[model samples]
Target: MPEANIADRFDLTNWKTESLRMTAFLSPGSPIPQQNWWEEICGSPPEVRSSQPRTGVQQDEGLFGDGNTQGRLILAVQPSRIDWLLTVEVVPTSFELPSVGSFSESANSFAQLMNRWLDVSPNLQRIAFGANLLLPFEDVEQAYQSLPAYFPLNKLDLKNAQDFNYRINRPRNVDYDISDLKINRLSTWSVMTFTAFQFTNVGSYTYSSAPLNVAIRLELDINTSIDFSGELSKDELPKMFAQLVEYAKEIALKGDIL
Candidate 1:
């Protein structure tokens, strides 16, 4: 399919993406070698970083940047689960019309990089892949108002809430065990809290600032897991991802669910 065809489907405007991640889960006891894997695949050493507390995985992460492609690769070891993960994140240069081709090419390159790494560590088993698309709106109220035009609201109780926020989580195909395909509305708000100190015998109250022009976020996370015992090929990886992107667009344009 032509790149412009995919780009036009979203009717994208000025927007920001947190990151686009593609991950592979290795079977237990299959550890990556301590050699120069990044240097061999990326032609340079990756910038190292630490894991966050929320991730629950205490491991150093290797990050590589491709200036030519404007993409990044993150490789991290999950000690808790005995798995290794490889993630690729790419930022769009032109917000007016983001190029899906660039993202696809980057994903294909990442798959090739993984294939090279697998050459040395052949014991690794099982592979699961997924992507996330985050679209932000400048006026969340207006964005919410426009949802009815796309989704069929007959099954949805729109009057239940004044400021509408809804979510749908369902499997795309049961036989493949593919899941986490969702369409939802998200918002940002503030909260007030009070704190008390025992030693000082004093109490204090605080309130967060009201959110400004931050846009309402619409997130779609699609995932699929497969057993490693089956055939693994990089040729079809990009095609599968493209299909997922198209599926997401179809949902936004013609899905019946709210």
Candidate 2:
């Protein structure tokens, strides 16, 4: 493809600006469950009874699957507890640049940076590298601006994921089902948006969220229930955001689209 196509399609210049919103939720009470925790299955829980579905599969079977799938092992917040859900949602809004190719390339670069960040998070370290990789998502407000010819965008959406259920219980996660893949004229820049909801592992926390819900659920089964009722400080949000902005700037400047 032409250089203009490549640059517009893969560039991420606008997202590096300091206008997007990002947030993180931390849970500190759920206890990590080990193999010994499930000594007594006792059938299933109430959530299973009330879960909505129209397929032919049983609820437990659908949720837990056949049990032989790789990464499909059961997770108990505690040796004997499965009562609450904890979830953390980090929403980052990025802007695409003039070249669709560059925008797409920048989207990929942004995803890569998040992958590297996961590698450093002490809580997410145990999970396989690149197993449940992050993906760029467009915010609802940006749906209209995501048109193919728009070229650049005011904001791009994305998510950080962990212990994906389909991967954990279904042997492998080889499907790319999320729609809205915008590849520029030269096929260099590509952007996609989607959502995920489930109870899962994060560091020592067990978080849960529904695509339709507003507040993410967080669960910790630690010996002592975690309490953050004003025990923490939050004056560093700006500094952290500034650092991420620099990271994005560096990536856009490098202009590598492989």
In lDDT terms, which candidate is top?
Answer: 1
**Runs of candidate 2 exceeding 4 Å displacement:** 1-21, 29-233, 256-258
Stretches off by above 4 angstroms in model 1 are 1-9, 12-15, 28-35, 49-73, 79-132, 153-165, 173-211, 225-258
lDDT digits (tens) for residues 1-258 of candidate 1? 111222233443222333344444454555544445556766775677555556544443465444333334565555323233334343432223222223334444445555565554433333334333333444444444344433344433232235554556444542233233221222221111212222323254443332333333344444443422443334544444445454544454444343
* Residue-level error in angstroms, candidate 2, position 127: 18
Q: What is the TM-score of each candidate against the true structure?
A: 0.49, 0.19
Model 2 per-residue lDDT tens digits across residues 1-258: 111332333234233211111122232442332222122332344233222234211222112222211111222232222221111112333222111122223334333433333332222101111111121333432322222222322122222332211101112111122122111111112333333444466464576543421111111011111222321123322233234334333333332222
**What are the Cα lDDT values of the candidates?**
0.40, 0.25
Candidate 1 lDDT (Cα, 0 to 1): 0.40
The candidate that wins on TM-score is: 1
Model 1 clashing-pair count: 0
State how far residue 254 of model 2 sits from its true place (Å). 1.9
lDDT of 2 at 213: 12
